[model samples]
Target: MKRIFVLLAGLCCISCLYPQAPATEAILEAFENRSRQHLLHENEAYALTSFSPAYLFDTLLPAAEARYKKHPDTWLQVHLLRLRANAASNHRNLNNNIGIRPESVTLTEEAIRLCHLEGNDLLLAETYFDMAELFNLYARHEEYITMLTKAFEIADREGHDYFPGILLYHKLAGMCKAAFHINSYRESIHYGNRALAMLGALKRPPDLHTEIFVYDLVGFSYKMLHQADSSIFYYRRINELLKGRDTSTVFYKLWSAIANGNIGENLSAQGNAIAADPLLEQWERAGIGFGDSANISLARKAQAANYFRKGEYDKALQCWLFVFEWSKKEKHFTNAAAAAEGIASVYRRKGHVDDAFFYFRQSQVYNDSLTAFNNRSGLQAVQAKVKLENLQQSLANSKALLKVEKRSKQFLLAGIVLLAVIATLLYNRQRLKAQNRLQRLAQQKREAELDARKTKEEIENFVRHIKEKNDLIDSLRDKLSSDTALKARQDILEGLSEYTLITDHEWEQFKTGFAKTYPSFFPAMAARLNQVTPAEERLATLIFLGFNNLQIANTLGIGRESVTRARYRLKQRLSLSKTEELEELIAKW
Candidate 1:
């Protein structure tokens, strides 16, 4: 009887050590229930400060691990993996750092493998959505688009609605916001329209949270596009929605004030300050009462804009200057840029070119700072993607090796004496496969090299043709200078000069050819040399094509000294150091 009791106690201890399948399922279900609430409430600060997924992940980690060990290949293990990945991704999303992002990606990939194995489209869609957000936050716009596309396809094919559709809309809004930040207002409006259309197609209206977001994006996008009437239309929609609402909560009050403020700003922009002032005053009072400094600042800026439009120069200058200082001090870069631009405009109107130029440069500096942050994030995103691909390939190779081993074991068990022959056959098959792969890769490399060489030769030939034309023109000019037949020589010079002169159409054709041959060249050069003139761009292109000053002069029908002076000016325009070789820089570019 005592021995039976001991055996029963040991069994109970074992059961306690590893949670049962039912208990694991319960934990996952509870987590999913909480996830919906958390997703809704996940504002800017929620990820770092809230305790849903992060803390819950810790609490369930041991149980999940034990359960996964007991049922390594089950759906429950996939859920555990996905939950852990969510926790990791949330942690990474709180900051722009990519250090911890790869771990999250690994966990997500593991979950994805299980999802594929189990044929769970819903979970696969969700995983893709998570990864899309990860990519978007890190500035991997192309990857974000790809992931979202895949997720939407899966969800649509499987008839999964609501959350998947909402996520698609959310990412669309994010893309719009990103476009807007880069001054791509048309793209922002395009995306905003698409998102709004999608929201309208849903069988049910979106929750207030989602509706507000869409309204803000569409409204701001139109505002940025300078479509004041359209901007006011959307802002008024938000106002209509909030008209009967209780403003007891700070969230409601904040949105309410923002909507009112935007409407007033648009009205002011449309030259209706009388109508706008009341709404602006309403927003100002609400903002100050709610302690919303951003809303208050925007109202102040709008008031300054109104003053400027009303020809109250002193008040406008004072107000704009205050806003500029506040924006700089608070590190509100976008506002700082706008304020600087406004000051620059005012100074220009007041005939202060130097002050205008200085403020314009300041505005440019702030705007460039915003773009620089995006560029840094894009670099990190690319690095993270490369790391993920390497890790995933490694995992796939390991799985393939294990699968081959299992098949080999099955074959060997059929007959031990046949092992050597089977091993030789398998080795020969793998060798052939590898050889074929290598040959394909080698062929592709050769084709790419040949194509590059051919393109270079074509460009060189074109430049040489231009040089020949210039040489012919110079020879004609020499004849006109020395010939004794005055009338005939003068007529020859006129015709030859006319022949050498490039028309706008011909110049455009040449530029088109250049662009087609070297697709990335002009855009890259233009970005490096901001606001470069057409003449400077043409000179830079010629300089890039291994042209000497004399060759450039002949090609453009100018003197060699003129070409030299142009080069010097270009160096200054590009802010190149004296030690830097322009030719070498252009070559690399």
Candidate 2:
């Protein structure tokens, strides 16, 4: 009896060491319950503060992994992998790491694979959304959009009412707004509206903050598109929603001020100065109270516009001068350009040609600086895009090779089973074909990369040449001023300006070269061409080509001040925002 008790005790120890894995349903239910709890409180603050990385890593992840190891089920493993990735991502984000962790991406990809294998559309959609978030964290915007689009398509196909569809729409709208391009604003509005529609369709009380966010996005997009009436309508809708809310809260006050400010600006743009003034004043006061420089400047700009429209030139001049100095001090080149232009306009209307000319030149200088900055940013974006595309191509090639190897193995097995004598021959032929295909793919990738590199180098060289030519012209101007006979100096200077003037034939040649370098430039400008004069178009092209204000003046054979005036006029014709970089818009187009 004692010997039997000893054996039972030993058996009990063994059972303790190898406990049974929880059922798959129980594991899933636990995950779902925790996820729901986290997501429910997620919007209380940004940065996923509701979800604890420590808890996920220390408790949930171990539990999930243990179950996954024991069961080895596709769904179980997918959930386990997803949980691991989420934990890693959360940890990185909490640490303020701007980049994504490679492990997180790998784990997410594995989860995606398992989801596909299990034929689980909802799981696949969720995995795609997580991948999109990962790409977003890495600032791989194109990849982020691609992933989001795939998830959205999957959600639509599966007819998932809320889990991902609404979230997808909301995210896409925000992404479009962040793109900072005019066309993207239209897309933002489109997605934002759809999100609102979906929210309305829900049976339960919708998320108020989400509704407000979508409304604000839609309003801001319309404002960027210069649809002032529509923008005002949406802003008013926001105000209507905020009417009964607690005005003492920061959130309510902020949104209320934003809506009022936007409405005022739109009204002013529509030439309703009387109606805009009170709102502008209110916005200005709110800006001052909040100490928000951007809002303050915007309000002041709108006020200046109203003053100018009301024939209050002195008041307009005062406001513009203040904004100009402040913007210059703050190094806000776009605002500086707008304020300088405003000052120039006020001076011109006051019959102060010299003052107007001086301010116009100032505006032009600021504009040139803005253009240079935008060009640099655009070049960086292009380089990044090329790198991303190459990476994507490489990944595609790797996937293809994997698929080929998988198929080859399957074929080889079939051959061995059906005809053992021919198995070796089939394997040799398949191996040779795979090798040939790999070589062809490698060659294509190399050629494509070479072409991209050559194109980029050529564009850079073209820009460098333009800069060198401008430098030469500047040197000539200085030499002529210093060495010319005093009596003939004025004549020489005038003659030089005339000599530098590009003739029609020269312009045609220049345009041809430009088209070769940037084939889409003219086509992108086609819609706006009718809005500007031929001279304005030429100035814009030179600016887009990276010409400084002095270079543009020399090329056009005009006074430097005249070039500045022309730029100011061009900006007005474009109807761009006070802070919108002209070159940035052209580059995006």
Candidate 3:
């Protein structure tokens, strides 16, 4: 009877707390109805590439901020608001530059900080999903995958809900795409299938757009893995989905062209260029009509690949040259490099040794430029991490100082109270003591600065050691390649490949050393070049260590022209004047 009464009391308390469940449900339903109205008109309200959509953020952000201030502890509410702000900012910025935007990163970091305070795992998972998007914008594939894994784990633990599942599906699909870009075929396929599984697990079927992207990612991943039949199956599935859809819509035509082009590319890859011709032509026509020069160029490249596969060297050479020129003209270094490489390979096949060497050197220059660009991006991430750490440390110091100050004030107040109750003689003595304490604190700060410089020097030495190890590995590789009689040449080559690429362990060590030595450098550099890459950062590191162009070129195993070109490209990315030296900037950093 006591247990029953206890249960009854608990139920009564719950009933008292939530007495208006029915009314609450009605209000929620009304809000959801209004939200659906907005979702339905998203194209008009939130365009993919338009500043006009920014008004939505301008209108919604103030309201969201106002509400967030009222319920500061509700992380989910604030995160959703932040997501809207980020999306709106991205929509506006992507119209001008498709690379990472400053505002998006700022908003994502804010959301991440809020996620820590959320306490609820599910809400925190959503914030992770938002962070993955920001990482994706910066082309940080590994971090993107890591954040996605966190979100997936929490969502799985919490038991899948429809809303979170929607995000998971999209994120899974995006991870597949990113993995493909980074050339991790197995991981791409894994995430692609995960997305497909997510679609199956959804209570409501995915909409056409989601289905299209999922199919495309899966199909592309399969194509890369050389699973022709499996790839063809998914591409055909996309065709089935697009069946009877309005062909007039830009998205519809775009996907249609992509799907058909992919099918042709698959056929061509299988040594049937003749069979691929019709589809390739169709895609090219559609791309040209749509004013998508990039896609048109891609179609041409595929056609060139088809010709090369068929041993039509002249035709292949013509197409490759056209692609190289087009890509170079557009400053698409990656595409240009690919084309130049292709041209060089064709020249070698035709026994034009000099031409082959020239184009090969040109390809190297472009490749090195791309490498430097990627390195710069890594430097920026390192900088951001260091900056965040410094900010946290500063915050900790401020809190500590505030606590001390508060305690001192409290003691002063207490002393005043006691003085009023007893005597006034001690008040002047307390004021003098506080002034003396302030002077000591100032001296301590100065000592701390000197200690920090010492630590910085130690970290610089460690980073220098890391660089020496890298240089040694490069020298070893060159020696091995030169020594044709080396018995374990292939084994050594495989081992070198494994070790030379930056593993997570090595990256963590580098980050730690960088953070210690260049605590303020990365943030300043990142602010100047938001889209910097890892290769550029590596170059900058060497530059900072007093390596000149020739030395950097030798260290990186690229030609001096490549080094010079990389510097030029870095200058452009940094928006520096021609007179402003990159080395000078690195020195400042």
Given candidate 3, what's the lDDT at residue 211?
75
- Model 3: lowest-lDDT 10 consecutive positions: 1-10
Q: By the TM-score metric, which is better: model 1 or model 2? A: 2
Predicted candidate 2 versus true structure: per-residue lDDT over 65-166, tens digit per residue: 776667666765666777677666555343335455678778877777665554566666666766666655545555555666677777788665425233
lDDT of each: 0.68, 0.67, 0.66
lDDT of 1 at 400: 81
For model 3, the superposed segments whose C-alpha errors exceed 4 Å read 1-61, 64-118, 133-145, 180-185, 225-227, 246-254, 331-334, 349-351, 369-589
Q: TM-scores across all candidates?
A: 0.52, 0.54, 0.49
- Poorly placed runs, candidate 2 (over 4 Å): 1-49, 52-59, 73-98, 102-121, 135-143, 162-166, 180-183, 203-206, 247-250, 321-336, 350-589
**Per-residue lDDT of model 1, residues 305-424, tens digit only:** 887888887777776788898899888887888889989989998999999999999999999986786676567546656765674577667668778998998887776757766887
Which stretches of model 1 miss by more than 4 angstroms? 1-24, 27-51, 88-101, 114-121, 133-146, 162-207, 247-253, 351-354, 371-589
Which candidate's TM-score is highest? 2
Once model 3 is optimally superposed onto the true structure by TM-score, how far is the C-alpha of residue 299 displaced, in angstroms?
Answer: 1.8
